[model samples]
Target: MRIVIVDDDPLVRMGLKAILQSEEGWTVVAEAGDGSAAVAEVRRASPDVVLMDVRMPGMDGLEATRLIVDSGSPAKVLVLTTFEVDEYVFEAMRSGAAGFVLKRVPPPELIEAVRVVATGESLLFPASTRAVIERFSEAGGYELPDLTEREQDVLRELARGHSNQEIAGHLYVSVETVKSHVASILTKLGVRDRTQAVIVAYESGFVRPGDAAEL
Candidate 1:
């Protein structure tokens, strides 16, 4: 996979580039020290993924991510953050980031996270999602006014990180049914991917963070 690494710290960018390049079939096409540079590199390189730091001197990753996605770049932005509950990380997700990885993550896990994101096979939020929502969400009790009850069920299942197959089985519906529900949820929420949609679920309290295990 072709990738871009973005961080304000040169050392952080170096370390991430080295770790990512160690994997076979992966290439670090470019590196950037901040969000504007990151966006430029992404345009020039057109990488499959961008490992983006949330904090930077200018244009922060959140805005860069918005600009990239809005410009119709196919590159997936996988956030690099030290804290999972960072308000910026939440904002990045809402800006259309594919997912995130903690900076202190083991090399193998970080590599795997990138691979998962690159393949477009999954949304990578884990149990840390709960902490992020609870710590950063501005409000609760928001309703899914546009979704049907069944679409709401599918959205909650999405919060659990279930695949379409899993959600279909759980809801006693076909995978196609789950896919349609997911598409509708995305449309109603006005987001790009399930990760963004699920963030909305959490922020809206439509799927409370604590409800993950039970749902």
Candidate 2:
């Protein structure tokens, strides 16, 4: 996969580049010191994935992600941030970031994150997602989408990180039925994948952090 690293800190960019380069089939196509440079490099180089830092000088990663997606670029952005619980991460996800990996993540995890994101699989794990949800849930309640009874059950299971087979087992429904419900949930939430659907469930108040019902 062709990848670009964007960050104001040279050390961080270099560290990430080195880790990514060590992996087979991954190449560091370009590096940018700031958001504009990152955007320009992405346009010129057309890397498959962009490892973008959230804060930068000329433009923030959020705005850069917005521009990149708005411009119809094929490059999927994976936002990098220091604060794991920051609400802006949620905003970045909503703004079209394919995934997020904490800046301090281990080298192996970083490589994995990039690969998963590049393959278009949204990465929302239980531990990080709970922190993100609680951060927003503290501010105010998020609005839940209008969902049928079955859809609500599916959302609850999804929020708990249950796959289709698991949710089907838990809900005593057919796997096909669970799949249909998940698809309906995604469509009703207006999100691209399961990760984004879970984000909407928490951020929109469809589900609250530590809501035992979800567990």
Top model number, TM-score? 1
lDDT of 2 by residue, 93-137 (tens): 778887688888889888888877776433445567556655664
lDDT of 1 by residue, 1-215 (tens): 99999999989988988999999999999999889999999999999999999889978899999999999999999999998778889888878888889999999999999997886555675677556755676546777667888998888887777778888999999988888888888888887888878778877877664687744
lDDT: worst 10-residue window of model 1: 130-139
Model 1 clash tally, residue pairs: 0
For candidate 2, which ten residues in a row score worst on lDDT?
A: 120-129
Collision count for each candidate, in order:
0, 3
Query: How high is the CA lDDT of each candidate model?
Result: 0.84, 0.79
How well does candidate 1 score on lDDT at residue 131? 66
